[model samples]
Target: MAKTIFITGASRGFGKLWAEALLQRGDKVVATARDLSTLDDLVNKYGDNILPLQLDVNDRAADFAAISKAKEHFGSIDVLINNAGYGLFGSIEETTEQEAREQMETNFFGLLWLSQAVLPVMREQGQGHIIQLSSVLGLVTLPVLGIYNASKFAVEGLSETLAAEVKGFGINVSLIEPNGFATDWAGASAAQTTAMPEYDAVRAAFQAGLTDDIFGVPEATTDAVLKLIDSENPPLRLFLGKYAQPWVKQTYEGRAAEWDSWSEIANAAHGK
Candidate 1:
């Protein structure tokens, strides 16, 4: 059976690729982008299977409105892929107040608004899935991507809590944590802060890690995404690339070790 999937940030990158894949497989898609013109190709190719809407996820009312439009058009929304977010490149010190606020606005609050809007509709239908686009950085810190990391970390917590809260209602929540992908995430989609003299070395080390071989192609993830959508028992979290699991494993191990080292202090603080 074909499903109705709503995806944000579908102008390009993984969002667009996934939208195309879904439509190709005969799924109805509500694709949203800030610039609707960029989605003309999808509109032309998929016709009624795809509905491209102009949306800036940061707007709470507009977010709800988009969800309403999609529900009215498609009858019921089966899934929502909250992929409307961008990277903010800057260390903690280099980041400006405006940049940090904007990052949270789009990445965190936007997802929140959409989730809220879809809940009543999904509750009425008695089944729906909410997929959040997080990152490996949500599991660990990376210099210069502090704001981006914070946004994803916030998403991680929000989605985890949402999953638990909505489980009994027959609504599902999932987080897609992808490592570096050959999308425009780090290119045209990214916003950068002014470089600081002290952070030059930090930036260099970060830049050095971003090599050609590290990124996975956007199209390679189509099969996994399709399976996830069609799943009877979907996971609360899904890692998209080869690097995500290994990298997150190491980060969690280190975190566990550090917590163990402080166990005595932690126990004492909790008041035995």
Candidate 2:
């Protein structure tokens, strides 16, 4: 059976990779990019199997309209992949108001609005899947990726709550937490803040963490994504790449230890 899927940020990176995989497997994809021309190759190759739309995603009205159009074109949306987001590189002090807003607008609010738009359609259909493109950064933190980290943390919370709310409607929500991949995510697709001198050492530490070995080949993720989409019971959070788990494991372990360490004080502070 073929699925009717809608995906954002389909011009390149994980979005383009996943779109091609779905189309090749006979799924109908409503793919969106800021510039429709960016999707020309997919349109030409996939024919009517792909619907290319021009979407900035930050425009709530446009996103809702795009979702509605996709619903109409495909009859029912079986899956919605919210992959339209970029990385913002800056420490908390180095980041400006505009940059922070832009980060949240694209990564958090855009995904929120799109998810809301598709929910009604999924409700009508009685089943659907919403896969969000989060990052391993959502679960942990890095020095200079502060704003980017916050945006994904927002996404993780949002998707988790959405899953609980929509489970009764048979709509599944999943967060795809990818580790660093050789995608434009941190390259051409990324935005950077004007570096402040105070954070130079912090930036150096961040740079040191981003070794060549941490990034997986972007195309290598397609198979896992396809498997997730096809799953009868997909996970609420699916981690892509082997690099994500160990770090997340360490993060959780450290968190548990700190919480346990504070248990006495935590209990003592409870005046009640």
Candidate 3:
């Protein structure tokens, strides 16, 4: 069956790749970007199968309106890909309060609002899929991306809860956690705070350690997403990229070890 897939941030990066791949596979795609001009290529290539809309995911009104338009045009939105977010790179101390708030607004609240907008339609239809584009950093943190990590952590928490809540409605929610990918995500799409003198060395070291091979191609991510879409029973969380599996595994193992080390005290506090 050809699904009517609504994707946010479809101008570039993983969002664009996903839209193009879906369109190529003959799916109906409602692709939204802040600037409609950015999606001209998609529209030109895919014709009526692609509906390019101008949207800022942070705008609640725009989100609702876009969802309405999609539902009107396609009759239903079978799938929604919440891929509209950017990375804000800086240490927590270096990132301003405004920057942190903005990051949360776009990455967390925007997704929340959009999901809310789509839920009603999905509920009425009785079957839909919501795919959230989170990051491996959601499971584990790293230096210089504290705020970005915080946003993704929130995404992970919310998506997990959402998955459980919506399953009864025949709505499936999946979180795609990809590690570093070869996309404008780290370049043009990223926002950086002015560097703090104290954090300069650590930032430099982090940048220096990044290698080309460390970043997988966008097609790999597209393939993973397609598989998730096709699965009769998709996972609650699907981690992409070569390092995602090991990194997430190690994080859980470390967490389990810490919990086990303190289980006696933790349990005692709860009982008494």
Candidate 4:
């Protein structure tokens, strides 16, 4: 069966790769980006199989409209991939309040709103898949990326709850946790920090370390995504790349330890 997939941020990076891979496999893709002009290559190559739409998931109305157009184009959307997001790098003290909000608006709330918009159609159809693009940082907080971590953490929480809630309704939700990929996610694509003298020390160290780790081979993650899409029952969480595995495991252990430390208080409060 040729599945129909609507992917946000399809102009570049993992999103574009996924769209191309899916189209190669005979699936229909509603490829979207804030500027459709950049998606000309995809449109020219795949033609009708790839419906390139201009969409900024941050705009609620535009998000809904894109979904609606995709549904109409393909008859129905079998998968919704919320891959629209950018990394905002800065320390808690250095990052502005507005920067933090903008991060959340696109990374967290945008996913939430798009999922909500697609729900009615999926519910009526009785089966659909919602794929969220989160990062290894979503599981663990790293210095100089507090805001990005926060957004991903919120995504993790949202996907977990949404998965359980929608499972009974025959809808599935999954999270794709990829570590640094060679996508244009770094360099020019990354959000620049509003440099602060107080954070100059860590900023220098952070940039150096991050630059080295940003060029991961994206093929590994793309393979993982193909396997997930083909599986009869995909795992709720899929970790990609060597860098992602350790950080995610560490986060799991730390979270477990924290919960155990507070178990007594939690049980008492619940009258256990």
Candidate 5:
């Protein structure tokens, strides 16, 4: 069935790819970015099927207004893709308080506000899908991406709880956790703080070990996203890319080991 899909950060990266792919498949797309001019090609190619709008997800009023406009234009948004976020590349100490707040505002709070705005419409329609673009960093920590990791971790928690709370209303929520992908994510879309000399070696080593070169194809990501959207019983969390599986597995194993080792003490504290 052709559906109306609303996407954020649709100018480039995964969001752009998703919007294009959906449009190619006959879906109606309301693609938004901070600058609507960047979406000219989409409007030219897809014509009326694509609605390009200017939106700053950091602005709560704009978030609500965009959702309302999309609903009004397309009748009801069948799928909402919360992909309007950027990566903050810096260690926890190196990242400033303002930077951290901005990261949270865009990556976490923006998603929350947009979802809140669409919930009422979806509830009334009794069916909708909300896909959140999270990262493997949301499941595990990385050395230089501490602030970005924290923001995505918050998104994972929020999306999980929201999935449970809205399932009764026929609204499905899913988080897409992708490992390093060939997106502008690390290049143009990423923000870095002032480099510290002390962490130079660590940063160099991390960069040298990057798997992005081998496993960061955007087409594969688009395919995974389309599969999630088409699934009748979509998973609460869908990990994309080959590396995501093993990386998340190792993270969960480590967490389970730590919890098991402390289970006795943890249980005792409960007055048992």
Candidate 6:
């Protein structure tokens, strides 16, 4: 069945590809960005079926209004993709307090509010899907991108809890974990490079590492997403590319072993 889908950060990158893909599958898409003018091709291609709107997920009021408007336009939202996020690449000591807060506000708090706004509607209707665009870093932390890791780690935690909470409400929550994609996420959307002199070598190495040669095709991930979205038994977490699978597996295994090793102390601390 063709459903109504709302995707944030639809102006470019994965969100843009997803919108086009969904529309090709005969679904109605409410594609939004901070600036709707950037969605010219979509508007020209699928005028009525694809509704373009201006949305800044960080703004609670505006987001609510946009959802309401989309509901009025498309009847109801069957799938909500929280894809509006950026990479803040810097060490913990280097990233300012303001930058950290902004990072959480956009990646964590903004997602929370949007999910909250959509919950009531989905609950009343008795079915909905919430998709989060998490990173491979959500499962594994690396040097120099501590703040970005923190934000995604927070999402992973919250999304896990939300999956359990909304199951009874007939709502589904899934996290999309993608590795290095040929998207502007690391290129155009990257945070300002600060604390340069302190970690010049590491910073330079990191910059040199982000190349399109290693990135996977965006369509492959989007195609996997389409399958995931349509599957009757969709996983709570979906790893997009082959590059991410090994990392996700290793992270889970390593973390599990570490936790198990500390289980005795953990239980003792809890007075078990």
Evaluate candidate 2 by giving its C-alpha RMSD to the native, one decimal.
0.9
Model 5: per-residue Cα lDDT over 111-174, one tens digit each = 9999999999999999999999999999998899998999999999999999999999999999
In the range 74-145, model 6's lDDT, one tens digit per residue, is 889998999989988877788888899888889988888889888888998899999999988898877888
| Candidate 2 residue 80 C-alpha distance from true site, Å | 0.3
Tens-digit lDDT track of model 2 for 113-200: 9999999999998999999999999999888889999999999999999999999999999999999888888889999999999989
lDDT of 1 at 220: 93
lDDT of 5: 0.92
Q: After superposition, how far is residue 213 of candidate 5 from its true place, in Å?
A: 4.6
Candidate 1, 82-121: lDDT as tens digits: 9999999988998899999999999999999999999999
Enumerate residue pairs that collide in model 6. Answer: none
Q: Name the Cα RMSD for model 6.
A: 1.8
Candidate 6 stretches with Cα past 4 Å from truth are 205-213, 260-264, 270-272
Better of 5 and 6 by TM-score: 5
Worst 10 residues of 6 by lDDT: 205-214
- For residues 1-272, write the lDDT of model 3, one tens digit per residue: 89999999999888999999999999999999988998998888989999889998999998999999999999999999999999998888888989999999999999999999999999999999999999999999889999999999999999999999999999999999998998998899999998889998999988997988789988877787898998889888888889889988888999999999999999999976
Off by over 4 Å in 3: none
- Model 2: residues with Cα > 4 Å off, grouped in runs: none
Clashes of each: 0, 0, 0, 0, 0, 0
Q: How much is 122 displaced in model 4, in angstroms? A: 1.2
* Model 1 spans with C-alpha error above 4 angstroms: none
